[model samples]
Target: MDHRSETGHVMFLSPERVFYAGLLGRPRNRSTGSLLIYVGLGGRLMLTCGGRTQADLAIALIPPFVEHTIASDARSSLCFTVEPESVTPAALDLLARRAADQGPALAERICAAYVRLREGGCGPGFTTEELDTIVLGAPLARRRLDLRIAEAVARLNDFSGPAATAADCAAAARLSQSRFLHLFKQQTGTSFRAFRAHKRARHLLHFVNEDLNFAHLAQDIGYPDSTHFCHSIRRFYGLKPGAIFSGSRDLRIYRGAAQAEATAVAALA
Candidate 1:
């Protein structure tokens, strides 16, 4: 697994897997496929998952089935995502609440304890008691609607392109549109449309930087036309696609010309 920033990285852990830890750079729409316990050591990062915003100076204990996209500041950060299935749901819920409350000190302690367990520093039977202590000390109990909204936002990472409307998302959550909107704002502190747009923009930026196949990238990401695509690029980044790729002069369009060139190169190679 390449954890390097420019090349994007992904790791998969089976249900039995436990205590996976590492240092990560600014991650874009990278799926963990399990619960993630991220500790931000240096600069702040903006993490959009499950319709929630996990931003600056915060430690995140993400739940399973959640999708996360992270953008780091100038400094790099250390993050760990552990599969929490081995622990009781009560413990997991407690940790999630602590992270939501931005309890970095408590998060750090938990991480340290986890690392010790992974490294054989602690005996086999110690985990249950330790987790209980941590959970008891941490703040717990948040609204269920808030957690559901966060789960919805996290689901976006599974999407390869553009996102469904708030109504669409609300329906998926089995809630009315109005109720979903209210809960989404209350939980994540941002609107559903805004969250979707941010996720799309991040995906677009990744495609741009990676020089991915433009047309497919556009369609994969949910834009009907180059005009709409370009408009979105401008709206989010404040720069036209042309301006973004102006000097370098690769294919100006994301679809036809660029795809043709890439196809030809692949055939020849």
Candidate 2:
């Protein structure tokens, strides 16, 4: 098999979202908190979930927290991860339709946008709205969350800040813990714990290119220990922490304005 790595791929990162176009390393089961959209760049893609394998797929949309393994015959792919809380049900339904149809039209547009961003000399300052416009033809309608739930969501998404527990967020929102958890699920369409875990895993992308100690990194990200960190990373990304870092070495990452201040290497290209 040809083992030459595809270098110089691009990734755009923003709050509650990520767009990645790069190598699809060895596939393993991964269950992530973000609704996943996978688009093949070359040959057909294969997706296996729930004991069933679907082959010759050009596009697939997998909901959040679904355990699945995906691979592309071409060895690389275009993937977009939409945080469940960010979009309305209607938008998600539209995405589902597109994915179900194996949207050649949508996939072609997304591929063009990727090419534009990669060769256009753009930096990481783009907003999520702009990203949506370029890739999906318009901004995805935002889900209107409750004020209290929105506050809690903000706290959880701010990965650079001190970790906030459910109790902390509940207290800040002035609600009982039970009520808070219930409302969080109702508004976000995910449990508070699952959302937090996904945020922690997503935050790892900010430091993927850096040389950092795993133990300390674990603590920095609020993981109880290195073992938990490794397990969570593997669960979400289907790759070990070390493997993620190594694979991302040649990948150029663009962080939105919110993350640019927290991660200096977001300027890398």
lDDT of 2 by residue, 142-226 (tens): 9999999998888777767788899999999999999999999999888899889999888898788678999999998889999
lDDT for position 3 in model 2: 29
Q: What does candidate 1's lDDT look like per residue over 37-57, in tens digits?
A: 665544565778777776674
Give the Å shift of residue 20 in candidate 1.
Answer: 24
Q: Provide C-alpha RMSD values for all models, in order.
A: 12.9, 3.9
Candidate 2 residue runs with Cα over 4 Å from true position: 1-6, 262-269
The prediction achieving the highest TM-score against the true structure is 2
Per-residue error for 249 in candidate 1, Å, reads 11
TM-scores of all candidate predictions against the true structure: 0.38, 0.92
